[model samples]
Target: MLRIILLAVALCLGPIAGAAQQTVDQPSSTIAVEDSAERDAAIAVRIRNILAELEGYEDVTVAVTSGIVTLRGTTVDQALAERLTGLVARVENVVAIENEVRQTTDVVEQLDPAVERFLDRFRQFVTYLPLALVALTAFVLVVSLGFVIARMKRPWDRLAPNPFIADLYRQVVRLAFVIAGLVVALDILNASALLSTILGAAGIVGLAIGFAVRDTVENFIASIMLSIRQPFRPNDTVEIEGDIGKVIRLTSRATILLSFDGNHIRIPNATVFKSRIVNYSRNDERRFVVDLGVAYDTDLVEAQALALETVRNLPFVLKAPAPSVWIEALGDSAVTLRVAAWIAQRETSHPAARGEAYRLCLAAMNAAGIEMPGPTYTIIGAPASAPQQAASPAPAPRQPAKAPQNQDLEAQDVGVQAEDELDEMISQERQEQADHDLLSSAAPEE
Candidate 1:
């Protein structure tokens, strides 16, 4: 054992002694590094101190060559070690970082294609940060437009920006700006020409779509026209195709209404454009005509005066325009009278005022004892035109002297026989006439 120990000692010291001898024999030019031994030792000591400081940190190691640094160890995360190396590089006298730290996980096994693609896309996005900023700006502009549109209109101002129009404008302008932003983003990425190519290909398809949806396109155009012309606005009461409702909202396809029963109605914009619209609120004043017919014998003056008073008393009726009454026409049973009145602010309470006028006028006519005419018919049967007869008829000329006729039975027998013969002849003639009348009644009339 002692022999083996000596042999091992000699083996270890042999290379050291030889190296010392070589250093003494060789010229200084043979050494690659020019720094003095003291300066090298000082640098080594400084690096050792830094390594000692980092020793407490898990999975970290430090090494130094000359003024250069090398980090080596099995690191939990290689990225963290790399970042540490960069941080150390920022410190003074760190000539370079070797970054020899090895990741605990196999790097080749961790690099999946999808992860590589993600990294590539991340790099691209960083490269095109300006495009991303423009997209953000577009979002901000759209939101700002919405705010401006909402606040632009004041409800009471007659000429204030209409909310619907302003909102539409904002939407269109914002959409245009966003599209422009997208175009610019595509251009920055050198892909704007791809969009033009896609559009060129889609042009054919778009023509087919246009033909298929021609009616829809027409309605869209009509909606645009309606928005521009603004024939009617929100909150206006209108009658279209016999449907009357308050306008609530207008959209590209339809106009929404709130019916009297609180049901939501969506009438197609095309229907609106086609139908007749009576805008009751368009004019501040409206003319209302009420027709009343009274019995022919009723006093015309009383009827006219009562109608005029009733119309004048209506709250919505305009006093300046003045109510007017006219005798319209004379009919079979009654005379027609018309009452015309002008109404101001007609939208406020139209039906109520008109109903009140009708009721009050009827009541006034009733108070004045004016008879209102109703339907009547005259029967033209025989009883209505038949003549009357007297009870005795002048004693019929005192008929003649059949005196002493029955000078006994002779006179009575002779008179009875003559009367019987006359009665028989009369009965035969009457039966013939009755048969003729029956035949005539059964025949078809020409």
Candidate 2:
């Protein structure tokens, strides 16, 4: 009876155990499916949030299933659609993407935001109109005041002797006032932020312009320096960089020269400032040098004495500095002598004095029987012959020319007149209307 009861109980317990196992396994599988669904929903929400944050993706929609993401809706273009897909692909737990986004070319939709922005700006400008007008009025008044102050001449006159520099000073003062006025106007209008931006841009542009026009700026600066230093005056004969001429005018850009050949030369002021200048008119007296070659057999001492005597007798030559002659070099066939004499450049013509001295010296030497020799040459392959010796020539008769009693230097009137004409021209150019106005105004009635 006990065995029979045990068999029946075992059958009932076995079925109950199997049913419990099936129930546990079913719950475990359902929990996993629910967890995966939650994870996919979370990923889809994150993708939507990310796409919304990006520009031009406001209308984009995102969906996710089991680790796969889907991007759908309209964007501006295909590029934006691809960009959305790319962004979604980077999210965690996303394995792939299905992009169904399309581009819409609706003109009204595109232009609506732009029109709204412009209208908003227009409204703001309308609100600020009165303030802008006031600022403009202040600027004009301040600029006018600057102009009036610049027209005053006394300060610039005291700054420099050159009229050009005085004008520059006036302009500088005016520009300073104008800048200050602009700053004040900008401050009044509460436009300091705009001013700062404009000034920054202007600074960059100014740097570029400065690099492009560096040479022009240098020349202009050199002109200012030359004007202040007064290196050469009008009608002064100057040789600058081997260009010999008389200075006709000193303009802002270049130094105008009237060449001896009647040609006009315009040298950049920068070049003139840096070059070596030989001014012939600075000193009243100038020395002239003559190179004389005498035969090797001639007496150098007697030849020098004769040359000195001839130069000294000339009326145009200066007696105080006197004349000098020296043996310069001894060549194969002749001896070279340097004869130098000082002449009053303002009182005598330079070329005329030199020519007269040369003529007199040659005549005196010829009459004195001094032989001026030429270069002697011999052939290399010539028949060898006995050298013939000639008889020594007798000394020529000493017939000295009578010297003038008056030793006073005579003035050359033509040079003085030419210099005066140049002075008059420069004076005319320098006569400023500002100076005239200052002088002509009848004391302003006190």
Candidate 3:
């Protein structure tokens, strides 16, 4: 057991000794090591002085070797270390900077292209900032004077009372001033050539993209046209492409409609602009024609008068248009008449008003002793009582011709069968004469 323990001890020590030897003999790959020592010392001293210059502040430390500077310390914020690194790098001989500094408190670092671009733009503004600022202020003052001049050019009576239009005009003037200020600032920065080059490149790229998305471009243009032309404004009820709804909003590519059932429908602006649109609320006057049928036996004069009265009494119906009634046609069972009335505003439910008018007219007719014809069946035929029979006295019974077996010398011995035969022959002759008379009556009048 002792030998076994000794062997185990030897095994562990052997690997440790070999590893230590290998580590001791490892060669360094750095060049100029001996020559760099003095330079490194100088760099360290310089970094120490620079750090000493900032030491009064809390939670920060700095380290340096050769031309490489390393920040090592706990800071209340990591951004302080980053900002210090940037300031030190601008010094005479900062070959490299490594931020080993850690924040004592939690801090969020956000790196975004838009943010970086904004910072770069801010730096540019700082370099030529004061000139740009002064130019912008002057431009605003000049644009305000331009608005004053524009207002003066127009008559006071012609000036719009709309606040929105006034605000829009102000915004336009401000935007123009800003654009001019930007051009002037670019000139001050000696960046006019760069700006032009970027603009030209952007125009070419934009043209290519526009061709690639021509349909989309067309829709965008159509949206612009719709906005400018004001074909339909928000909340206007319109029928486009057979779909009826109120305009909710107009987007770059489509128009949104709020359907009566409260659905949001998006239709392409191109389709809306190209299709026929019937704006129901555009006109203040709308006409409604009510058609009704009365029994032919009814008094037409009374019905016409009652219909006109029904329309005249409705408050929504316009009087100047003058409600008119026309007997349209004589139908199979009734006389059809149309009553037309114009209302001032079409936005009102005209169909409902028309229905109410019909009900009122029906009631008025009933009160005026005029009857609406219900479905009726009329049968024309002979009277229910006994039909008129031909006026003729009964024919006398003829003497019978005897059967051969019953033959007798006297003819008064005739039985019933002989009388029946004679009667049938007379009936057949009467039927033939009746048929001939009927055909003669049916012939042409000439």
Candidate 4:
């Protein structure tokens, strides 16, 4: 056990002794050593004078022997202590340096330097106060001029198509002028280099905010484009993406619509801009069709002529384009005939006119003994041996309907006029929210 203990102790001491030996005998690579003691004393005095002339090194003491210099004492911080080795090496005939300076623990030593720095900064600020004041005044004046110009509403309102677009123009003008003010102030202060930093920071913040509100930005841009190009006017009946309604107003973020059923719908401007739009109110004339089927054995020529005459005699049908009837297809039980007619859509309700025309035409054909049969099926393979039971009384035959006389069907009040209720609602909405609406009736439509 004693032999093992002795071996471990020897192993640990061996590396330590070797390391110390190598450190102590390391040769200086910088300068040749001097033999004279007087030269060493002179070197120490010169280093002390150099330390005294510089700040943060007052407590540092220097000693020299045989061309070697040793630095001892403390500094306020490690950075200053580490800086001493490079400064002392620049001295003449210094072979090597032992930098023993350390960070000081005394609070007064640290506080004194901070107070001296503050006082020095104060003196420089007092000297340059007049120039700083001039720069500040220039900045304020420039910014105030920008504000003054932005507040004038005439130019922006005239340039923009609507209030929403006008507000955007004013905002852009204000931003541009603010940037100009910053540039002028920075130039006056001789700090134009800082402009790049400020702008770069602003760009990063703006990019992040843009991503955060991407939908809102898209909607705003769409509103600007829509306001410029006036797709539809107030009270125009349109179908957008499948939603059929009358246009109520255009807003910054949304397009408001009043549906035919008197329900309000709000769609985002982005969706509206990208969707396919069908403006029914843009054209005064619209075509409606009524499909009727007659018995396959019936003469197609006579059926077409009868349908055309029935649709043409309707009071709401436009006479210039006239009415048309054609054999559409051979249906399962009859021949389908498509009858189409043009109408003044604004004056006539399309659905009501179509329903009334279908009723009158079918009655006229039935009264003329033209059969219109529904689908029929014949059951086969029934056994005659099936049981027979007493039958219930048969239902009475339905009476054939008669076609109305020309005088009776020629009235204008026969459910063909368009409804005005939804139009009234939309007009009221537009009146109450006129300030926010971007659409104008007098503007040319696209």
User: Considering every candidate listed, which one attains the maximal TM-score?
Assistant: 4
Candidate 2: stretches off by over 4 Å: 1-105, 380-446
lDDT of 4 by residue, 262-350 (tens): 88889899999999989988898989999998888898888889889988988888997888989898888888999999888777888
The best-first sequence of candidates by lDDT reads: 4, 2, 3, 1
Q: Judging by lDDT, tell me the better candidate of 1 and 3.
A: 3
Model 4: which ten-residue window has the lowest total lDDT? 407-416
Q: Could you give the candidate ranking by TM-score, starting with the highest?
A: 4, 2, 1, 3
Which is the leading candidate under lDDT?
4
* Worst ten in a row by lDDT for model 1: 405-414
Q: Model 3 residue 100 lDDT?
A: 71
Q: What's each prediction's clash count? A: 1, 0, 0, 0
Candidate 3 lDDT, 232-277, residue by residue in tens = 6555567888887766555556776766665667789899889998
Q: RMSD in Å for candidate 2, one decimal?
A: 12.9
Off by over 4 Å in 3: 1-204, 296-299, 328-333, 346-348, 368-446
Location of the lowest summed lDDT over 10 successive residues in candidate 3: 437-446
Overall lDDT per candidate, in order of appearance: 0.62, 0.74, 0.62, 0.83
Give me the overall lDDT of model 1.
0.62
Tell me the TM-score of each prediction against the true structure.
0.44, 0.66, 0.39, 0.80
Which candidate model has the greater TM-score, 2 or 4? 4
Model 4: number of clashes?
0
Local error of candidate 3 at residue 278 (angstroms): 1.9
